[model samples]
Target: MKKFLVVNAGLAALVGSSMAEAGFSPYYAGAAIGASQNNGSEAQFCDECTGSKFTMHKKNTGAKVHKVYAGANLNPVWGVEAEYANLGDTYSLDMYRPEFGIPGGRAETARARQKTRGIGLSAKANHRITRKTSIYGKAGAFVWENKNSMDYTNLDGINEKYKSTDRGVSPTVGLGIEHEVTDRISIRAGWDRTFNTGKGDRFLELDANKNVTDLHSVKTDTDMIYVGATFNF
Candidate 1:
């Protein structure tokens, strides 16, 4: 009876250890939503303004900030992940320059529709703090596309429409903490920012007369804070 009891105790210990270490799979997927801010100064032309006091927002149908990603765990500490971010939003900026137009110059209105989206792959490194929790950091390059349109309305009620597109590769970095909620599920909260984004700019055509004729140059960028969940397989 004593010998049988000793064998059973060893098996129990082995099973418990296995359960504790079995949560991380070779593959995983996750999704997150949070707030994103678009920090691009609105620039004006034709009716030339020195500085613009206007702001823009990234418009989304669901959350202000959203992202979806999937990755593989090469081992306990290293892996790779690919992500897609929806940074689409809109805003309008109106400026009045006392010296820009002649006497009784019309108000300048710019109704802007901005679109910013990105997809990229990153190398992730992990550090386990406990059996169920870990913290990680990643660095990668994202090929981001920025497409925007603006409708300029003059005081005289003359309107002009223009479209602009900008696409390039930008360096991205982020850090986060993740905890296992269930054996195959986990939750994470993180912040990620891309650097040196493109400014989708378009220009206006004006004669020497300096009339508020057509379109102009504009700028845009990306920043976000997110909380998300993941599933392992």
Candidate 2:
């Protein structure tokens, strides 16, 4: 993470110095919506993960993503951009933890959610493929923050909650295409991936009467694809 920060700072300083000497920069900003897919192999949750027996269930996978970015298009082939991206709070998972003590097989309802948001700064390189079309790639650093929460409801109408929040810095890489429909407007399609948070080692635990337990683990790394319009000034 420190390396990512150092690299970006150096690049930013270089860009600032170059633009200062040239006295001008082409600036633009845009918004996009996409699907953020949670990698299956990277995160796994089990109710009895720390016990002799384990029960596992699937969590929400593909989630809606939104991003807004502004940048200086320093030249025809290179630029620098800053972006804010969010996965909101729509993704969730539900499970049931059964207890034999209830006689009629009583169980508690369980639900959990992990929401992700980040701020990123990137250096982009564009390659013209046609008269009005180009392909581009980007590399950047993002401070990814995630909020994880869990809730439990018993048959007797009691509620309990567990929650945790953490942030990490990771590298982001992407490839995209742009088509200029007019001199000042363009259509873009892109895919990007943010590296793992490296802190998925925690779990949520809810205990009722010291007999039944519900546990859940979470991770919030992201892979996404998006389409949006860019308005250039």
Candidate 3:
């Protein structure tokens, strides 16, 4: 009986130690720097028409903007984040209204240079899958700032400028893993996604006869891949 009691006590102590090692909480904050890809698509029409009334038509013109960013993460399980992503100059397909008959019988080419900066906040939840690894998903809001410049040599052999700063709310979802490399340090990696909102879309007018219009009613999604070192106190 005495030996059995001792064995049970030893097992209980071991279990307690394991639980201590797993140390989890409702709050944690960290910083991460990563590479992200912004993928967006939209359609356009004359404001008077409900996208169906326009004599000009283009189905789904899209763009892919790739960038690198650094940011801090705060986890209250319902917290906020501030990140800055720099997009150098990403290009995409620019279509025009084929129905509009031109004087020279030539279709205009539409193209431009674009860069984006994002500042945002989010809410997140963490699920511990193992002693040193966890998975998480997040959703939140953001304000994306866009700057666009256009070149319409096809229309007037001249350049134009169209710039605007718009406000938008975006939602994000992500998964993450944490591994303890030591008692004071750990390595973490995660992927996050965000869907952008209405004011997020902008239009560009190249020349009087032609324009490259952008309609981003459909949300733009961004994917992030990051690995960072963390300090636990």
lDDT top scorer: 2
Q: Lowest-scoring 10 consecutive residues by lDDT in candidate 1?
A: 53-62
Write model 2 residue lDDT over 86-199, tens digit each, in one string: 855423556665675344466667666767788999999888787778898999998877777777688676998777777778898999998877766788999988776435
lDDT, residue 212, model 3:
46
- Pull out the clashing pairs in model 2: none
For model 1, residues 1-233, the per-residue Cα lDDT tens digits are: 99999999999877656644945677999999887665554442323443443222323222376889999987778899999987655223434432254546546556655566889799999988887899999999988876656676666777887776667788888899999999889999997877655643533445567554443334444667899999988
TM-score of every candidate relative to the true structure: 0.72, 0.74, 0.55
What's the distance in Å from true for residue 80, model 3? 6.1
> lDDT per residue, candidate 3, 21-100, as tens digits?
66443233456666655454323212322353223323222233333323333332233444454432222334442225
Instruction: Show model 2 residue runs off by greater than 4 Å.
Output: 1-25, 40-43, 46-55, 60-62, 88-92, 101-105, 205-220
Backbone clash tally for model 1?
Answer: 3
Give candidate 1 regions above 4 Å deviation.
1-22, 42-47, 51-63, 89-106, 199-221
Instruction: List per-prediction Cα lDDT, in the order shown.
Output: 0.69, 0.70, 0.49
- Model 2 is weakest, by summed lDDT over 10 consecutive residues, at 47-56
Best by TM-score: 2
**TM-score (C-alpha) between model 3 and the true structure:** 0.55
- The global Cα lDDT (0 to 1) of model 1 is 0.69
